[model samples]
Target: MENLQMLMYGFTVALSLENISAAIFGAVLGLIVGALPGIGSLAGVALLLPLTYKFNPTTAIIMLGSLYYANMFGGAFSAILINIPGDGPAVMTTLDGFPMAQKGRPGQALFTSNIASFIGGLIGMFIVIFTGPSLARLGLNFGPVEMAALLLLAMTSIGWLLGENPIKGIVTTAMGMLIATMGMDAVRGVPRYYFGSIYLMGGVPFVPLVIGMVGFSRVIGLMTDRKSAPPITERLHYRDCMLTAHDFKRLLMPSIRAGLIGTFIGILPGAGATTAAFVCYAFEKRFKSEEPLGTGAIEGIAACESGNNAAAAGAFAPLLALGIPGSGTGAVLLGGLMMWGLNPGPLLFTNHPDFAWGLLASLFLANLITLAISWVVIPILVQVLTVPIALMIPVIMTICVVGSYSVTNSMYGVLIMFIAGIIGYIMTELKYPTSTLVLAVVLSPIFETDLRRAFLISGGSPAIFFQKPISCVLMIAFFIFLALPIIKAMWKRMRSSKGGV
Candidate 1:
């Protein structure tokens, strides 16, 4: 009942005219950005972060939250109409969504995605609304040791889940940590890797690096690919907007289950929409005997769409409850919060009830706007898939450049974007997953800060990691995730030997 009252308050805050406008704007912008290949929500949010400085806390949050959900709506375009995924989370959608599109049912595929996403996002939002205060109460007990362990666990998951090889993932994580250490140490007031250079003193610019690796890199790769492909018009048909009763019945359970899975994963650091989507896909394959996956199964669509959108909503849990960002997009949102001179976490609700409640309220409105717009625009949105890759690459590059430069108005950032684009292209050629590298970059800084704090609090004793039950359990979990691949490989070899004998 208390939770219900709080939700009512949140709704009241979110339903205001200004917040509604913000949601609409954010949704529109997010859709446009999410439609572009390789741009993704992280890049979109990073580009928009600077603008948050100009708005109130509630307004800024409404905008960012809308963008987060809107990206899911827009991401389906490329997945169904084209084989390319608009964002990382949408990659799973492509596996089945593209196949559905190829069968001349693009509208049906997209409709499933939007509806499932809306359902999932709403479920996640409710989970947060009801469970957040309790979670925040628990998070209050987290000390440096717990934070260190949590970060370690998260990094391990990211390292394992984002790529086939954990070694490369770890290496990328280490590189990001090194980059994060370049700025002046907050505790010591001394720079570690600046080399007496003025620009180095401030550390690597996060927005530039994020845009460079995520946005510009895709541009370079696409430009190279454009040399051989003949231009073709993307054709989309909107013959179907409503799902049959059978289709709805078939998808409901999976969407709900996926929403739960996605929300749970979203609350944890290092787990984001892509991981949620994959996990939900695996779960669907295991549980749904009637629906074979990876073949345009409605279950597949429900799982991927719900899981990804739920993950977006779930990503807010840590941010609102504990001030930890669950993913790169979370980081941008967190920065926006701080930019408004508003700090998030347990006290945020107490000190700024309007801001906190208002933001949560706006989520419902945002999801509604997303669903309505996506439903209405499915046909035209599908036409976006027909854009020539050659023509689109230049425009994408321009957006990337502008976004990167907007981060700090530094020419050096543009240079960084170009350079990172080259590095990203090279990594792609080597079959190294960019997701692993980008996630590593996002988490390394937090891991370093917390690790250092943990060591300091424990008088430099390593045993501090295992002193608490939660910390100890998380550390063990991290080790298991790190070891699974190696163990599986050895098991394979042993089985082969036994068979030969």
Candidate 2:
């Protein structure tokens, strides 16, 4: 009852015309950004962050958060219509989304993604409402050891979970950790890897690095291919494309399962929507053999779409309640909070209930607004694919250069972006998992700072990690994640041996 009242209060703040309009604008912008090739929600937010500096804290959050969440839905249009992922999380959507669109049911594919996104976002939001306070209390009990162990768990889980080649994932993750260590050592007051260069003083700038790796690098790839995306010629009415009662009944369970899976993954630090989407897709593929995946199956769309959006909403919990970012985008958002003169963590709710609640409330409204925006503009979004890849390269590259400089108005940022773009291109050519690298870069500072604090507190005793209950559990999970592959490999060998006998 109390939670309901508080939610209503939040609605009051979120329902204002200015806030609603901001959300609408954000929704449209997010769709265009998501529908664009070589860009993702993270870059979209970073590119637009400078513009939002003028708004009040709540309104700024409403707009930025809306854009972030709405991008999840927007990415599906391209994935379905053109077989290109507009955002990292939408990569899995191509497996089934494009297949569905090619079957002359593009409208259905778009509807599935949007409806699943809405349901997933709603489920994730309620989970946040009920668990945010308790999670905040839990955060208070986590010390440096626990935090270090948590970061380790996230790093290992992502690397192990994503690719068939765990070594490749680990290598990329290690590269990220190394790159993150280049800046000054705050604890020791010495430069660790800067080599006395002023450009390296703050380490690799995150915005430029991410924009280059995910956005600029991909732009180069598309240009190299020199092939135009297939145009969508479907002109079906929205009603024909909308979900029927039977379709809802069919998708209900998958939506719930994916919602839960995504929310749980999102709550874990360093996990993100891309991970969540893939996890759900793989799970459904493995267990629901009755319905084969990657064949334009509605179940496949439901699982991936719901999982990604749910993870986006779920990623917010750790950021809001614990001052910890659950994903790369969450890390960017933490910076936004600081920029707005607001500190994240448990005190945020107590100190500024209105701001926190208002943000939450806006998320609810934003999802609905996204649905409306998607229905209206999906036709235009489909036409975007027909634009020549040759034309987009220069435009996206220019945006990347400008965005890199905007990070700090420094030529160094642009240089870093260019270098990162080259590295990103090479990494892609080598089949390295760049997402793992992104996660590591985002996590390394927290891992180093906390591990150092733990060492200082424990007088260099490594046993301090085992002394804490949460840390011990996390350490055990880390070891388990590491062992799973070996165990599976051994089991496979045994099965082969038995079969040969």
Clashes of each: 1, 0
Q: Per-residue CA lDDT of candidate 1, range 101-134, in tens?
A: 6776777788888889999999999998876777
- Model 1 TM-score is 0.88
Candidate number of the best TM-score? 1
Off by over 4 Å in 2: 16-18, 188-192, 236-240, 279-295, 338-343, 482-501
lDDT of 2 by residue, 23-114 (tens): 98888888888887657787677667665666788888889899998899998988988798988899999999889887877888889888
lDDT score of residue 377 within candidate 1: 70
For lDDT, the strongest prediction is 2
> Worst 10-residue stretch by lDDT in candidate 1?
228-237
RMSD of 2: 3.7
- Looking at model 2, residue 452 earns an lDDT score of 96
> lDDT of model 1 at residue 153?
77
